[model samples]
Target: MFEALYQYQGQLLQGLTTTLIVAFGSFVVGFLIAAVLAPAAVYGNLLTRRIIMGYVGLIRGLPELLVIFLIFYGGTVLLTKLAGRYVEVDALTAGIASLSVVSAAYLTEILRSALLSVAQGQWEAALSLGFRRPRAFLLVVLQQMMVKALPGLTNQWLVILKESALVSVIGLEELMRKSVVAAGATHQPLAFYLAAAGFYVIITGISTLLLKAYETRLTPHMR
Candidate 1:
């Protein structure tokens, strides 16, 4: 077990890098979409709110694995048809896109709640200061919403980290896939599996600590 891991340390590192790339890429993309849609769902007209909420609901209702499969295979088919040639979505692209969809849905709800938690007076105060709605929200409301949403966002990121393992099914040699191959090759499933678990724990632990520190720094008033 240890022997195999030690021998394949370089490959494992590459796998970890791939995992991080997928997780962080999706997280950022999802946050950007959520930052826009969350506000629309909260402040837009009935039709717009309905449309945003409906999307959120639909994405949340489906399983994450199913979403990955759809995006991976369906995207390939769609692209192939459009191009009139064989086109396939690589595992990394599909993984990021699918997870981004999943992340955006949850992030929207988290941000919507955070935005609501902000006092209406904050908006009024910004307006009184001669700030336009967009400027007010960006400068004032967004900061507070982020502070309020930090814990949820941290957890959501961890969720994304774990969900990235599902991408292995599509043949991306991410950490989980690498671990599986190592286990099979070494005939030491338990050792490699536990090692993989430890790797996940270490990454998630470090992320949680960093995010918490940032959260504390952002909300010093709460301290």
Candidate 2:
């Protein structure tokens, strides 16, 4: 296994890079969408809240792979039809969109829970001092919610990272896909897969340390 890994070192690095790119793209986009979604679900009017809730419910009900297929293949069809021109989506674009949607559902819940965890007293205090509710929430509650949400969100981050492997089905040249190619070429399935798993372990291990450090910074009790 080790010899095979050494021989295919360049492929491993390339795969790692693509994996990170896909993960980063999905995570960033998902977090931004979730930031809006959580707040809208809580504070928006009944219709808006219901709409957001329905979206979350729908996503939760579906398998992740199904979601990816729907977005990738479905988007291509819809785009081509709507535009009256053939439109093809690249694997990366489809993968990012699919993963971001899944991540957003979890992130929305994490953020909403964090926001609700803040004391009502603080909200009232700000209102009593003449700050509008929205302004107060933004100025005070948002920061606290982010701090509280970080640990859970980071766990979700790792989930999305691992899930990116599923994009191999779409022909994305990410870590898993690269590993598959190498394994086929070298006839060392176990060795190549073990190497891929090790790469993921390294990424997650480093991420865990960073998350811990950030958590300690945000909440001293974590130390």
Candidate 3:
């Protein structure tokens, strides 16, 4: 087991790198999209609100693996149709796009919940103090909302990180995919998978601690 791990250390490290890249990229893109969509869902017109609601519902309803398959395969087909020839959607692109879509749904819910958690009275108080709607939201409401939102967002980040393993299905060569390959070749499935789990645990532990630190900074009184 140890020999196999030692021999494949380079491959494992490469997989880890790919995993981190996909997870971080997806999280950032998804969170930003959610940031915009959350406000729209919370404050936009009826048509806009309904559209956002439908998107969130659809995403949340599907499994991540299924979502990945659909995006990669469906996108390829759509591109082929548009170009009037067969087109291929690369694994990395499909993985990121699918992961982002799923993450965005959760992020939208988190942000909307945080925004609503900040009472209307706070907005009123800000306005009474001569702050405009935009300023009040940007300054007062956003500060409180972020403090409330951090924990949920961090949880979502962790979720995305783990869900990244699903990207291996489309041959992305992330950690899980590499582990599968190593397991097949070395005939040491348990050892290789255990190593993968260990890596995931380490990353999770570090992220959890970092998020806790950030949360304490955001809400010192709670600490």
Which candidate, 1 or 2, would have the higher lDDT against the true structure?
1
Which residue pairs in candidate 2 have backbone atoms (N, alpha carbon, C) closer than 3 angstroms, thus clashing?
none
Model 3 TM-score, 2 decimals:
0.97
Distance (Å) between predicted and true CA of 117, model 1? 1.0
In candidate 2, how many Å is residue 85 off?
3.5
Q: How do the predictions measure up, each by TM-score?
A: 0.97, 0.94, 0.97
As for TM-score, the candidate ahead, 2 or 3, is 3
* Model 1 local distance difference test score: 0.95
Q: What are the lDDT scores of the predictions, listed in order?
A: 0.95, 0.91, 0.95
As a whole number from 0 to 100, the lDDT of residue 75 in candidate 2 is 95
Estimate the overall C-alpha local distance difference test score of candidate 2.
0.91
Collision pairs in model 1: none
By lDDT, highest first, what's the ranking?
3, 1, 2
lDDT of 1 at 101: 97
